[model samples]
Target: ARKGVAKSEQYEIRREEEEMRSQMSCHSLKKRAVLTTDSGNCTAEEASESEAENSSMDEGDDEEGSHEESEVEVLDEKGFRRTQEKKISNVKQTELKAVEDEEDDDVENLLKEEEEFEEKIDFSADTAGALKWKEDLTQKAAQVFLRQQQSTPNLRKLIYGTVVEDEDRE
Candidate 1:
């Protein structure tokens, strides 16, 4: 009886181990391989193969003639990308055609707008004279340097007295 009980416990432990092996955390599974199809990442070869499969599926769906928006997610060596396409029905197609016809009338207004943008690239002479302050840049900088030098007292020289500066170390 004791031996049978031990055997049953051992069998239960083995079953638990098998279950743990089969079930894995998402993080561990994804990190197992960089380009494994199981983890939603694929190498270039797998990417092309999947694309071919998608194309065949798309060809079959063409017969259904459903105008629903479709989204496709492509996973490849570079990265993952999702693109969506909306299929236009006859009504939307006619709307687009009408918009294009309206745009034809707006082309002349767009050309006229070009003239407005072309004006005033060179400012009026009135504003040009306002830049007279910037004319003597070098002289202004020199004047500012001298003024600051005269205004801020040299605290070090003032503390030590001028005798140190007046002294000829030579």
Candidate 2:
């Protein structure tokens, strides 16, 4: 029974240690991911540094055949690292492009809206101009009608007296 208790305690301790180790590893991976992303932001700077390193590595690679094999392995490692960096940079670039596209679309929409607003303003101005002309026409018509009324003092006399004047001439 004591042995069984000891075994169970050992099992529990081992399980707890495993869990803690897994948690620590997860935390470390998160930290590394964050660092990688932060470093990835300086792509131009890193590219220059990598170019210098590659030149130095190439010089080292030229020494011997056996050294060349070792250099190939190192180059493969560097290649893998570069591919990951490139993927991160590509993702960042695509995100920037998407943001720029959205801004362009917003600008286009604003321009279209402004054009529509200008059209509406122009239409309103034309309508106002037409209304002013209509008002002027009505006033002119009224004045012309008043002048005709003044020329012919009475409507009945103008219609009836003309016949009387013709009969007098006969």
Candidate 3:
């Protein structure tokens, strides 16, 4: 019991450290940066469209080996939303020293890429006059997809009904 409690405590510490790292990385975006996307609000139709896209992609894609990163959007403290690709690498490979080195390099490269993206989105100077909202469509889609998933409690009500949910409620 003592060993088990110690292990669980260590696991929680690790989780908190990872959360802090994610927060720092996500918050690095500049406030004054004029993001290319002007996404005002997410709607039901938009959510459905994202669901359809996700469903179709799920059906046709069984080759999980080919995909390394899955896109997810994290909202910062300032409510600035930016899309990031979350690495879903296999845990079996975690022991590899080469993979560790590669991941370190990848983190550095990812930071550089984010900086470049922020720079690209900043159109505060003005020049072409035509604003490009099309560039961040995929990011918008990812956000919509996340929104739908986050509403899973509503889905639970529809599927399991209030009866089952009520019994489980604290």
Best by lDDT: 2
Q: Provide the TM-score for each candidate, comma-separated.
A: 0.20, 0.27, 0.22
Tens-digit lDDT track of model 3 for 44-154: 112212322233334334223212111112213232223222111221122132235555556445444543454233222111222234445455545644565566657
Question: What number of clashing residue pairs does each candidate have, in the order they appear?
Answer: 0, 0, 0
Q: What TM-score does structure 2 among the candidates reach?
A: 0.27
Q: Candidate 1 — which pairs collide?
A: none
Candidates' C-alpha lDDT? 0.36, 0.44, 0.37
Best by TM-score: 2
Candidate 2 yields a Cα-based lDDT of 0.44
Query: Where does candidate 2 stray beyond 4 Å?
Result: 44-170
Q: Write candidate 1's Cα lDDT for 5-119 as tens digits.
A: 9999988988896576445332333333322222121121122222233333334453223211111121121222111112222213333444455553354344234322421
Off by over 4 Å in 3: 31-170
lDDT (10s digit) by residue, model 2, range 9-121: 98898889779756655555555455443343223222322222333333433223322332243345546445334433433333344445555455444434543344334
Ranking by lDDT: 2, 3, 1
lDDT of 1: 0.36
Question: Which should have the higher lDDT, number 1 or number 2?
Answer: 2
TM-score, candidate number 3: 0.22
